[model samples]
Target: MVDERTRYFRRLRRLRNSARRWSVMGGGLAAAAAVLTPYAGIGLADAAWAAAAGASVALAGWRWRDHKALAALPAPPPPDPALAGQRLVAAVERFPAGRTVVHELRRQRTRYALRGSAVAQAWDRLDRAAGTLSALAGRLTGPGEAAVLEAAVAERWLRDLGQRVASVERAIPLSPVDQRPVLASSHDSLAGQFTEGVTAYERLVAAAAGYVAEDGQPVVDERHPTLTRLIEATDRMRGIAEGLSELRRHPAV
Candidate 1:
């Protein structure tokens, strides 16, 4: 299937072609009209030609306007292994994700970080995952087909899961004596899920790294070895953290 980027560039090429045709047709018509204008009222042909001269000039100018737009819309590189790796790594490097997340946590946001807690452990796991992604970014852009596409997705899931885990961890310590037992259960649930999510994240990364390097063709999404399962597992952990935090705020009587 043609991806959106392919369709988009196709459209631009079509427009560029159209503009070239109009410029040729319009310039010829305008020249004819100019020659005809000298003989206006001499015959019906000259009058009609002069009357439509501006239309031709306008068509010729279409090329100039469209050229600016075409210049602005540069086509993406053709699909290849290097481009694939570049895109995935760029996503990993972008806002609130990957190595950026690791740097932000260490350099700026360490104040709220609870040492040796589930959140802390999750962060450490994320650090390792980021390292794996960094290697993949440099070495394994793609084969942009199948489960390989989900590599960035898995990292994002782990990142989001970390946010939710942090939220729940913060709320856990502040619970009242009566709610400690229930809150502790919720915290343990988060810890378990985080461990599971990170484990799967690493395994999935391992498969992807090996596959592109020398392993073999990866399975498609339905049978993708690890991504879907990791996504679902990470999603569930996020829900647990979010729900636990909400319950702490409005405890049931």
Candidate 2:
């Protein structure tokens, strides 16, 4: 049996479906009435009803066009080596930039959150990368099934990472500079989460590359080094985090 909430959603879905059908039906009837009214030479009252129906049809058409445009927005791209490389580079670039910006923002006695304007750009980039993986899941062929699961896990990791970053911003008090211990801890947590996501994607890419079609052909070319470069980029970001941690612990003169 369906749960009550599920049942409610099901009912809502049905209602929406019915509404769509009626909208179309109403529009068609209106158009037909308008077109055929002239031959019938209907009275003015009937003509007014026909005109109103036609107007309703036009409104429905407009609504349908709007909905179609929204639905037509492209989904994220597949996990191609080129796309991976681009994302990897993008993620790495943002990692340092985010740190720098957040550090500077902390110095200004401003509250930094994941939703903060400064870090939001970085998060958006990271989200786009994750979205690319998600889009690829639907495009994957047989034997590359693991990529789909990995994409799902990656999405979850991103959400957790976002929360961790937000927590870091919140853990510190508003100050001119970010010198709090919790900031470092939160940064470490955020980096760890990022590494987890990257590692999962690496496994996903490897599995996707290894996938053999029913005809015994590899899905991804081993010779292309872009994918390897993408994996290396993620590793480099992980290394950067470690280096940052070390610097924070043993400040250089």
Please, what is the whole-model Cα lDDT of each candidate in the order they appear?
A: 0.69, 0.61
lDDT of 1 by residue, 33-131 (tens): 677666334467776775566675686577667766876876776677677776766677776658666566453454245465567766676677767
Give each model a TM-score.
0.39, 0.31
Model 2: which residue pairs collide? 107-176, 107-177
Assess the local accuracy of residue 71 in candidate 1 as a C-alpha lDDT between 0 and 100. Answer: 64
In model 1, the clashing pairs are 85-141
Worst 10 residues of 2 by lDDT: 209-218
Q: What's the C-alpha lDDT at position 127 in model 1?
A: 70
Q: What is the Å distance of residue 195 in model 2 from its true position? A: 5.6
* Regions of candidate 2 where Cα sits further than 4 Å from its true position: 1-113, 116-122, 174-179, 195-253
